[model samples]
Target: MIWHLIAAVFAGLGAAGVGLLLRLVSGKRLPRWIVPVCAGLGMLAYQINHEYSWFDHKQTQLPDSARVVDVEKGQAFWRPWTYAFPMTTAFSVVDQDDLITGQADGQRLVQYRRYRFRKEYVDQVTHQAYLMNCTSRETVPLAGEPPRPRTEATQTFTETDPLFQVVCQQE
Candidate 1:
C-alpha cells in the first residue's frame, strides 16, 4: 500500500512538472492552478489503473496448477472520492493436488473458495467437503434409491436450485 502511494506521488510530481514547463513555454499565459490540477489527475489515474489491474496482477503470481473455480463482483464507497464504486472482477482458485488426492477410500474431500475485492481489502471464503470413505464399511448412496448404511440421501426435485445441487452431491 505504501508502494502504491509513493508511485502515485511520483506520477503526480511528474505531471506537475510537465504543466509547469508548458506554462513557462507559453509565456505564462496558463493559469497557475493548472499545475496542481494536472498533478491531481495524474494521481487519480494511477490509482484507478492500480485498482482495475489488481486481479490480473495477482493471477499472474499464482502457480500454473491453480484452478479458478468461481468469480463475483463487489461494490463499495470511496469516501475520499465521494463516489459509489463497482468492482466487477474477482477470482477463486483451488489447488489441483487437493482435489485429485482427496478422493480415496470411497471418500471424497473437496476444497472450494471464493474471493471478493473491496477498496480497502480482499475477502476470502473457503469450505471443505468430507464424504463417506468408500473403502470403509459404508454403502454408497444410489440415485433415487433409499438411504443406505453410513450414507445420507436426499431427493432432487425438478425445481431444485443448481447451486445447491452442485455442492450437495456426493462424489
Candidate 2:
C-alpha cells in the first residue's frame, strides 16, 4: 500500500517537473498553478491505473495450484473516484486437485469469492453447497444392463439420491 502511495507521489512529482520544464521553455504567460494541476492529474492517473489493474495484479500473484473457476465484473464506487466506470472486483477459485474428483464431498467443492478492491479490504472465499436432484425420467434402468454409450452429459450427473447437498453442512 505504501509502495503505491509512493509511486503515485513520484508520478505526481514527475508530471510537475515536466510542466515546470515546459513553462521554462515557453518563456512567458505560464500559469503558476500548472505544475500543481499536472501533479494532481498524475496522482489521479496512478490511482486509476492501480484500481483498474487490481484484478490482473491479483491473478498474477496467485499460486499456480490455485485455479480460477470464474470471474465477475461490476461497477464500484471509491478508490480513484466515486463516479468512475465499472471494474472487476470479484472472482472464484478452486484448487487444481479438487477438479480431479467428481464427488462434491472432497476438496473439489465449489467455492464462491468476492473482493471489494480496497487496500484495507481482504478477499472473501465462501464454500458453496449446491442442492441437486435427479429427475425421475433420467433414472430409468437400462434393459439387461449390458452397456450404454458414454457422452459428456452422461459423466456429468449420476443417478444417486435425487436430493443431495454438495458441501457438508455445519453441525
Candidate 3:
C-alpha cells in the first residue's frame, strides 16, 4: 500500500513536470491551471493502471500450480468508463496441486481449496476449502465441522465446468 502511494505521488510529479515544461516552452502563454490538471490526470492514470493490472498482480501472488477457473467482469455506475466497457472485477481460481479425488461409500468425492479475488475499494482475497460430492453436486465447508450434505443447483461438477476439468483432466 505504501509503495502504491509512493508510485502515485511520483506519477503525479512526473506529469506535473510535463506541464511545467509546457509552461516553460509556451513562455507563460499556457494558463496556470494546466499544471494542476496535468498532475491530476497523472495521478488518475496511475490509479487506472493499478486497477486494471489487479488480475495480473493477483495471478503473480498465486502458486505455480494454481489455475484460474473463471473470471467475472462488471461495470460500476460511479465509473462511467466501465459502463461502455466492463472490467474484470472478480475471479475464482482452484489450485490443481491441492485437489484430492477419491471415493467414499461408493460416492465420488473431491477436496480442494477455492481462491476468490475481488478488486474494489480495498482489494480482497479469500480461500476456502470444500469437500464436494461429485455424484450429487453437494458441497460442505471443511472448517472443523461435520460434513453436511447440501445440494447446490448452480454449482455443476460436470466435465464442462472448469473445476471438474482441472481435477478430472489430471487423471
Candidate 4:
C-alpha cells in the first residue's frame, strides 16, 4: 500500500513537471490550474493501471499446481469506463494436486480446495474445502467436522462450469 502511495506521488510530480514544461513552452499562456489538473490525471491513471493489472498480477503469484477455475469481471458506477471494459474483480482456483478421489455409493466423489481471490483496498484470499460428485455434478462444502452433506447448501454444476470440468475430467 505504501508503495502505491509513493508511486502515485511520483506520477503526480512527473505530470506536474510536464504541465510546467507546457506552461513554459507556451510562455505562461496555459492557465495556472493546468498543473493541478495534470497531477490529478496522473494519479488517476496510475490507479487505473493498478486496478486493471490486478488479475494478471494475482495469477502470476499462484502456485504452479493451481488451475484457474473461474473468473468474474465487474463494473462499478464509480468507474464508468468499466461499463465498456469490465475489470476482473474476483476469481476462483482449484489445485489439482490436492484432489482426493474415491467411490461413494457408485458415485465418483472428489475432494479438493477452492481458493477465491478478491481485489478490494487490498487483495484478499479465502479458501474452502469441497466434496464434489463427478457423476452427478453436485458440490457441497465440507464445512463441519464430520463433513456431512446438507441438501440446502449443495450446488449443482452444469457441463460448462469450469470447476466441474477441471476436477471431473481427472481420473
- Candidate 4 overall lDDT versus native: 0.92
For model 1, which pairs clash?
105-134, 105-135, 106-134, 107-134
Model 2, 61-157: lDDT tens digits are 7767555545666655444353456676676554443322233333333221222223225555554322121231121111223433223332134
What tens digits encode model 1's per-residue C-alpha lDDT throughout 53-78?
Answer: 77677678667755554555565465
Clashing pairs in 4: none
Question: What 10-residue stretch in candidate 1 is worst by lDDT?
Answer: 130-139
Kindly report which residue stretches of model 1 are placed more than 4 angstroms away from their true locations once superposed. 79-85, 88-90, 101-171
Indicate the residue-level lDDT of 50 in model 3. 86
Task: Looking at model 4, report the run of 10 residues with the lowest lDDT sum.
Answer: 143-152
Q: Which digits, one per residue and each the tens of the lDDT, describe model 3 over residues 77-151?
A: 877888887888999998988888999999988888888988877888898778777777655666645544444
Please list the C-alpha lDDT of all candidates, in the order they appear.
0.55, 0.52, 0.82, 0.92
Clashing residue pairs, candidate 3?
Answer: none
Residue 158 accuracy (lDDT) in model 2: 39
Count: clashes, candidate 3: 0
In model 4, state the lDDT of residue 16.
92
Of candidate 3, the 10-residue stretch with the lowest lDDT total is 147-156
